[model samples]
Target chain A: MIKENIAFKNLFVTVGTTKFSKLIDTITKKEVLDILQSLGITFVQLQTGKDFPGPKLDPNVEQLCSIRSESGSYTVELEKKITLKYNEYFEDFNNEIEKSDLVISHAGAGTCLEVLHKKKPLLVVINEDLMDNHQMELAEELENQGYLYHCTCNTLVQALKQDFSALKHYSKPEKFVFSRFLDKCIGLSDGK
Target chain B: MLRLLQGLNFKNYTPRYYFIASSDTTSLSKIKELEQSVEKHKQGEYHICKIPRSRVVNQSYITSIFTTLYAILYSIPLVFKIVPDLILCNGPGTCIPVCGLGFLLKTLFIKDVKIVFVESFCRTRTLSLSGKILLYLADVFVVQWMCLKDRIQRADYIGQLM
Candidate 1:
C-alpha cells in the first residue's frame, strides 16, 4: 500500500505543457477512480493544459480560481470526491509540487525533474502518442534510479496498486556544477 | 534556458538575455514568458528575435538544409547586433541558426563566443538531433543523465539542472 493516512489525501495530475487528452480521459475512468479511492486519494486535481476536456461531472463541479495572461491561461475546479482542481500553467508550479502527496504526470522532462527534486511519490503515465517517445526512456530511467515509477496510460490503474513505500528517497544533486563551469570559462574583464 | 539563466544569475554573474525563437505560437509564447520573467524577477536587459523555424516535424532533409540556411540568413543581423559572449541553447529548432551563426562568428575570429549546449533531461540513452549537432559544435556540452555521458565521451554529466 502507498500509505495509511485513514484521513485526508491529495493527488495532483499534470500533463506538462501540451494537452494529453488521453491522459485526462484515462484517469477519469471508473476503474481508475475506484483504485484512487482505495488508495485514500481524496483531493485529486487534474491540470488539463489549455483544453480542459469536460469530464462527466456527475459530482457537481465547483469553480475555485481562474486566471489568464497574454502568455498563458489556467483554470481551477473543485469536485466533491476527486476535487478536480485545474491550473493549466502556473507561474511557479513548485507550490503544487510541494503540496501533493502523490503526483501523476506525463513523462515530460521538466515536470519529472521538479517532482523528483521535491521527493514526491510520482507515477508517470507515458503518452505513447508522442512523436519523440524519448519520454519512455526518461520515465524508465527514473524508475531504474528508484526516483519515480512509470507506466503507460493503460497500465496506470495497475501501477497505482503497487506499494510506494519501497521506493527510494530521491536526493537530486545540488552542486553548482553549471555556475562553476561557466566561471572557469570566462574571467571578468575590469575586475569589479 | 530560463533555469540556466537563473542559475547563472544566482552565481552573481549579471548577464543580458537575447532569445532567438522559432516562429511557432507555442515557441513565441514561451519566449514571451521568459521576457516577462526577466522583467519581473530581475532587472536585466533582454531581446527577442522571432526567426523562422529552421525545421519542422516532417520536413525533408534537403528542405531542412535549405530552411536552416534561410534561418541563418534571417538571423545574421540580429546575431551581429547582439554578439553575445556566451550562447546557451537546449533542444529547439531555433538553436540551429542561433548556434550556427555564433559558430561562424567564432570561426572567422570575429568573436570568441562560446556555446553551451544542454541536452534536455528527457534524453538519456541517445542524443536528439539538436544534441548530436551541438555535441560537436558547442564548446561545453552537458547532459543530465550519467548513461548519456557514458555513451558520448565528450558530454559532461552535470546531474539535473531543470
Candidate 2:
C-alpha cells in the first residue's frame, strides 16, 4: 500500500449553495470514514452548505489537525488515517476541484459542468428533496455517456466502491462546429 | 456566449465585441476577469455593457411593467452603441430587451442585426422562459438537446455549445 502524500486531498464533497443534510450526515459516520481509509484516502474536504448546522459527530472521534479559524468556521480532522477539512463554502471550488482525486457533488448543473470541464472523476448524488428538479436530466445524461458515475444518498456506499479508473473521458463538442454553424446563421460564411 | 466569441476566427474581420453583463454587484468583479479573458483569447475592440434585471422577483405586474420599461430605456443606448451584425444570447432576462431592440432595428430598416437565441444546455425536455418568448422574436433559435426540436417549432437541434 502506498503511504499517504500530504500535499493534496484524496476526496472532495460539495453540497453547492443549498442544504444537503442527509449527504453530510451520511459521510460523517465512522463506518464510511473507515471504508474510505481502507481505500487509501488520507484527506477529505467537505463543503457543507451554510444551512447544515454542522455534523453531530460521534463523541469518541477526536479532531487530528490544528486549524486556524477564519469566519468562525471549524476545519477539523477526524481520527484514524483520514483528515477532514470542513468549510461552509469557498469563494470558488474550481481550484479545490483541480487538487482533488475524486469529487462527490449534488446534482446541480453548474457543479456537474465544472467537474466535467475539468476532466475530473465525478460522482453525483441527486438531491431528491428539491422541487421539480430539472437538474437530474444533466446528471443522468452525463452518467449515460460514461463520463461520470451517480448514486442517490442511500447508495453512496456502492458508488464509492465502483472502479472509476476506466471511465470514458467526456469529449466536448468541437469548439468550431458550433462556431461554423453560428457563422452560417450570422452570414459570415466565406462563400457569402 | 463569450465562448462563441472566443471560437470565432478573426483572420477575416475583427468585429466589435459587446459582452452584456447583468447590472448587479457581482458583475463588477466578473467584468475584470471577462475583460482579461477576451483580451487573451481574441483581438479587436471589446466593451462590457451592463443591463439591469428586467423584473425583480415576486414583483407585482404593475411594478414589473415599470422595471421592464426602465430596463428598456437603459438598453436603448447600449443597443445603438453596439450596432452589432449578430446578437447571440442564452436564456437570460437581459437578453430579451436587447434582442427586441435588434428586431426593431431590422423592421425599421436601420442596422441589420441577426438575433440568435441559443437555449441553455440544462433545458433538455422544455424551453426556458426566454426560449418560449424568443421563439417568436429571434431570426434563428437553436436548442442543444435533440428532444426539444420535436416539441418546439423553429428550434434548430444544434449540438451543445457550453
Candidate 3:
C-alpha cells in the first residue's frame, strides 16, 4: 500500500509518433481529470503526436514552451500549471521521461521498452483503432508477464486510480541479446 | 545493433555500424536517439543512411518504381565503399534494397559479407513483405516466434527480442 503522503505528482503522457486520439480523449475525461487532481499530480507533460485534436486548454492552466536562442541557448518558458503539446515531438524526450514519476503511453514496442528500460512505472493504453491490432497483442503479453499495466479507454480511469506501488519492478534481461547476436554475426563474418 | 557493436573489443577489426532508415520523423528521431546514446557513452563509429520511404499500401506504381530505383542507386556506392564483413538488418521495406545490395556484392563482386536478418516481433502470425523476400537473401534468417519457425524453412527461432 502506498503511504498517503507519497503519491506520484508528475506524469509523462505520450501517444507515440503516431496519434492515438482515443487514448488522448480518455485522459481528458472529467472523471480522469478529477482523479489526477485529487491524487496531487500537479504536472503533466504531454507529447501528442500528429493528428490528435488536443483537449481544450483551460485559460488558467499553465503552459510551458522550450525555445532555442540564436546562439543555441535552450530555455523553457513556464507560464501555466498544465502543459499540452499538440502534434509535435519533444526535443528532449528522454529528459521528459526522466523527470516524470509515471508514464502514460500508447502501446508501441519502442515506447514500452524505453519506459521499462528506465524502470519507470508505465501504464500502456492500447489503441484498438490501429489497422494491424498487433499493439494489443504486445500490450497484453507484457501485462500478463507483469512487466507493465495495460488498459483500453474503458479501463484507463480505473487503472490510473490503482495502487501502482504494488506493481512489479520490471527486471531487464541480464544478457544483452543484441550483443550476443552481433557476436554470432562477427563469427560468421570471420568464416569468410 | 549500434549499442552492441560499441561494447565489442574490436582487436584487429575496425567495427563500423551502419544504419539504413526511411526518411520519416519517427525513424529520424530514433536515429537521433541512437546517435546521442553512442555519443554519451563514447561508443563505436557509426553512419546513418536515409532511404526514400516506400510502401505497397497507398503508393502509386510510378512513385514506387522511382523510390526503388533511388534506394538501389544510393546503396550501390555505400555497399561498395563500406564493403562490410557483415550486414545486420531487421524486416522493413528500407532494408530490402540494402540487403539486396549486400547480396549483389557477394554474388557479383565476390565480396565476402554475411547478411543476417531478424524478423520483427510484430510478425507473430505472418511474415512481413520484407521478411518474405529476405528469406532468400539473408545468410542467417532469425524469427522471434516459434510459430514462424515452421513456416520459414531456413529461419532460426531465437525467441522474442524484448
Question: In CAPRI terms, where does candidate 3 land?
Answer: acceptable
lDDT of candidate 2 over A83-160, digit per residue (tens): 776788889789989888888999887788788888888889998887667778777777776988988888887787
Candidate 2 reaches a DockQ of: 0.44
Model 1 deviation from the true structure expressed as Cα RMSD, one decimal place: 5.9
Accuracy of chain B in candidate 3 (TM-score): 0.79
- DockQ (0 to 1) for model 3: 0.26
Residue A177's lDDT in candidate 1: 55
Q: Over 4 Å off in model 1, which ranges?
A: A1-8, A56-95, A172-175, A187-192, B9-15, B22-46, B57-62
With candidate 2 superimposed using the best TM-score fit, by how many Å does residue B90's alpha carbon deviate from the native? 1.0
Q: Would you give me the overall lDDT of model 1?
A: 0.74
Which prediction has more favorable lDDT, 1 or 3?
1
Better of 1 and 3 by DockQ: 1
Question: Which model scores highest in TM-score?
Answer: 2
Error of 2 at B133 (Å): 1.1
Lowest summed lDDT window (length 10), candidate 3 chain A: A68-77
B-chain TM-scores per prediction: 0.85, 0.81, 0.79
**Mind giving the per-residue lDDT tens digits that candidate 1 earns over A1-192?**
455633328888898777797887677676787688788777776777875535543232224323223323333333345545555656568888888889999988888888888888889998888776877998899899887889988898889877776677877555455666666667632222
Interface RMSD, candidates in the order listed: 2.3, 1.9, 3.4
In model 2, which runs have C-alpha deviations exceeding 4 angstroms? A1-9, A17-22, A49-55, A58-73, A190-192, B10-42, B55-66
Candidate 3 lDDT over residue span A82-104, tens digit each: 33333346767788889988899
Q: lDDT of all the models against the reference?
A: 0.74, 0.74, 0.67
